[model samples]
Target: MFSATVLWLLLAPAAVSAAPLTALTDCLTSSAVPQLLTTNSKYALAIKPFNLRLPFTPAAVAQPTTVAQVQAAIACGVAQNFTVTPKSGGHSYASHGLGGENGHLMVDMKYWTNVTVDSSTQIATIGVGSRLGNVAQALYSQGGRAISHGTCPGVGIGGHVAGGGYGYISHTQGLAMDNLVGAQMVLANGTVATLSATENPDLFWAIRGAGASFGIITYYKFQTFAAPNSNIVYSYNIQFTAANYLALQNYANTTMPAEMNMRMFITSGGLQLEGIYYGSQSAFQAAISPILSQVGNPYGSTSTMGWIQGLSNYAYMSLTTPIDYDIFSKSLMTVAVTPAAAAAFVAYYQNTARTVSRDWYLIIDLHGGPTSAISKVPMDSTSYAHRNALFKYEFYDRVDSGSYPSTGFSFLNGWVASLVNARKKRGQKADGCKVPTTTFGMYINYADSSLTADQAHNSYWLTHYARLSAIKKSVDPNQVFSNPQAINSK
Candidate 1:
């Protein structure tokens, strides 16, 4: 048998090092795929990460237009013993789109952008490079349809949907992954596989929530909902006060409706609420009344908008909508925030906001209700484990556009610990019952760059981690598709 580095020795110049990167470069050189090496000037712009903090340099960037070229890139990575990762929108919080580390193979999926909807079936098929905004526009224009997705118009649908996408309408519809009918991906050994409920069922389950760990999805087919053209959009600024804080906490724990989706921003300075009500102004008034009555009302306004306008409105909090500010974020999913935990959180937040030289905030989005569509999804149906979460909180702190402060993570880290620890403190009472501290968990989409492989698998997948590992070992025995947080084969 020939050596794996045989091509490296023959094709690569004598000075080039091994692990056969030189061989991989040579293989890509001959393939139809558009290849950009580190030496190339445009490689920097092409591989520029959305999160500037986690920087990386790949062995080469492969921009494949056709299915076969994508296969070709994978085959080359195999021969050269290089790690391969797909770049959909480059919006990974940990910059996993750039391979999350140096000297790996980056498959830039920018050229495969296509959004086609079947007017008859109302099922939409989208390509890997398609952004959320473009997908929403196509869904609305093609068939007056929509899907539950994130607000960032620039986020790539591949990663977003693969990681359990959610938005304001998720309570009414479901997560973006819940909409998927089928998906097409290229596996580690240059095998192109199409997955759905009946086809490659096991792999389908793995990719739906933890897709980035397994393979590169080429496109997705989703069930769509009739686009909501007439909707109520509201914004409010509430004064920071103890009464207001407790009132909002009680309100969050109970009383939210399925049709009324909301997210609140809490900081050391003040509090703001913004979201949509998929109903008329009068109905929205009734839905929002409980919170307003308790908080004693503050500065706010409301307006009606079509589906298109809402996407533009979010463009989500550093991310225009104050943070639209953070260079880092910690996401937590919980069934409910107990009264004690809430009070502890507010007190800590208020106290920290004044002392910390840096700025931080929390965007807690309501996702649970008696009739919430998200909760109805069975825990075993998809790889997404947080199906029953009542709320998803993303904690963020602003780090300016430069090298991240070496010791900058302390504030949010302590903030998360405070809430988790406080949850069990005094057996936190809520609705006359003690709430457990183990309920809240970290999220996968808001990937933290600081976690280890085991920590990430446990944090993101929880009980589903074992099955995902077994599937990873079966499909990707060599582990071609991976990043720092990627699932390891059992």
Candidate 2:
């Protein structure tokens, strides 16, 4: 029992300025779906973004339980000229799931969580609302199968795979997008289409990476691989001093094997190197011997556990603990780490650790080993453009609500910019390694809102922008599905 007049006033400046709120509300309610209005007590929680920096109050939140209901929601929004954003797990760094700005309709897909595995084909048909943890558990329980996805279990598969999902095993198995075989989506015009490399190929390519701007993905069919033997994985955690930063980078650049994945962190406690190997304990020990030789007598720990257990351990999540929404993130893709760049990074880390609270840290992910299979695919085969990077660097900080840093957000921004600049200037080409790189590109899943429109377009899409733009124009001519970093159909 929401008042249309009040809702209209709340959405006065929205894109659907001319549409009647009463008709829009009636259209949605007639479907007998669960809907939350601004007046509803649960509305606030429903619209909350993972990153609190982009707070938004949507006009209404629709929870569609069936594909027909999803179609109804999208059609109603279209007829009412309201923006419709599909939200799953609500994890967009910029909170694009909240419509990026206020007064739009949020189609929350949480009720659509379903994971079915075809034992014969070893394929997983996953709903857009399925989180990585649920999908993994379901797949592992039903059949010993797995998909290469992100580290965070709470991350939604829809957006994750849409933006080229990568995980620890990605170095050997390829990204989540690489395993995507087909998808069913609700387009801007409210039509349902099943797409794959053989059908609606261009749209298939576009949705693989630039999906947020094209349509609402309802489900994905991913090729699954047999789970690791006995679900056992070998992992190691090693601590290092500032002096060993360059040495660690050199090891990652040279001796690190494709069978293993390494992640380095600059934490307040100290610099830590965490690694995971998809092999036996003996193989892992032999693989990391060179690294151990360089950092003699360093503090380290190793363990062997089930794959799911490893994911849970790395995510550091408990049943009662929720992910922190009061956070900011910035990211860049690099081909190589140079001695000069490594030294500068250490200096920046020391300075930031002293200036900021203990909550801030830097994460450097090792990419490109057997993952070159990703590059072997034709560039135009999919919309995910960052196929050449050797590693990815991410800067994460906890910021006070509604208040920028004392020196301003620019302080954090400047640090990221300077570090990227240094890496670009002194780092060697990422070519000649297992990974082939002719240029540079950024990961779109780690979308940075601080980037200008032009910068985001160039960095995320790179050479694929023009083609993606064309597909966007063709599929969503009105640009119904969009966000701050979305592709421009026009």
Candidate 3:
């Protein structure tokens, strides 16, 4: 009876007109355009009202509340013969997630933000638009928690999962893709399907890492763990010289024990290290003392807090406050540098910032507890092939449309590329100081969408675009969910 009722609801006279969006009025049903935009647009768009957005505007935006509603929206888009884009948190730098440049419809998943736990099965069913802050707060209060995610917390799970979410716990839990148990997605053809390991395994495998190119995901299920009970000591701050950077990097590569969740961030200012010890303060101190000795100064202060509080501390240390949607919307860059390295970076950055180009700097965060267990799944099960990884890296820089300098942009990119090449060359010796290829893969979530086909194919040390393309084909034969960074459908 419930199923029939749902079907009836889905079949009800389309509450929204299925007309092609020939004019703005076709999408904005009410005369109140300001209200619609304020109420409907995602965080990034809403946050910076003055942002120079895409030239092509969306005719209408659909805020769906359920899987049926999502299907209905897709059907209406198909019927209207308009292109549609899926928006979770709108963290994407490109216009791919939102309707721009030929796309006429935008599916907003914010209304579907719901998180629930299946106590019996220990699975958490998260809505597509659910953000990390809410997810963490909810789970922590209920004695359940997820592995690390984006620091800001406003990023949506749909895009995160589809692109391969990684966080502080990534080094331990593996990618967020590893914990996803099932998902309910609305396909381009308006068909709704639920995929899991035991059911539709192929689709499940594809969605785990490369789901964005297939459909509009409404809700997803993940294997959850009991939240940590103890208040652990977290040592965090930004202060280190370039001389200490190599030592810190080497320590990160070796000295960090399993009990400590450690991540280092280097930028123009200096080096900041954030670490959380699952055990007591003394235990943490004893475990981390060897590495701290390298810094040659006592840590500024050590605060003890619960897991939830620890998250907040980590946020504060990173200069971010939890759930500040507006700030998070604009805070996209995360790169590494030391005071010694700052001059060169500033020379590149100041010039780029003055120009009208969108390039950003992101740093690698390698913090993981026992919770984020590396995936034991087969390498070929999904397109994401990185099996054993310690950390993932991402960097960003925003540029206004008209102010972008193409030559400056190329120089900045090339400069970074040169630095990476140098590092790769230094680590190339086969026998001594071998850089683990498995650990050398890029984090799919933070990959530059602007990279050419060849770049994306060659960037990751482990996974190749060919394998990713095959997975994309198997899941989305028509490429309905195509985007700049998405695997090409052929």
Report, for every candidate in turn, its global Cα lDDT versus the true structure. 0.79, 0.74, 0.56
lDDT of 1 by residue, 81-179 (tens): 888999998888888897787777899998778988888898888998988887888788886888889888888898998899988788788899988
Off by over 4 Å in 1: 1-19, 239-254, 316-326, 357-359, 426-438
Badly placed stretches (over 4 Å) of model 2 are 1-19, 31-33, 230-255, 295-297, 319-321, 370-379, 399-408, 423-440
Residue range 1-490, candidate 3, lDDT tens digits: 3332233233323223434454433433432222134344352243221112222345466666666666666666665566667878766644456532344467777776788877688788888888777777866655456555655566777788886776555544556778788898777777787888787776787776667667888888888766555546455454544445545555555666555666656444445676566667777778677777777755556777776776666555432232211010111111233343434433443444334333343464553222334434455776665544434444444442233333444543644543344444555677676543332355455545455545544444245456557755665566556655566722
- Which residue pairs collide in model 1, if any? 317-324, 318-323, 318-324, 318-325, 319-323, 319-324, 320-324
User: What would the per-residue lDDT of candidate 2 be over residues 357-450, giving only the tens digit for each residue?
Assistant: 6367777777653334454566677888766666677777765433334454665576665556566665446673322222446677887777
- List, in order, the clash count of every candidate structure: 7, 0, 24
Best by lDDT: 1
lDDT of 3 at 156: 76
Clashing pairs in 2: none
TM-score of 2: 0.87
Model 3 misplacement above 4 A: 1-20, 23-56, 99-104, 144-147, 231-233, 236-243, 295-298, 317-362, 367-372, 375-378, 388-391, 398-415, 424-441, 457-464
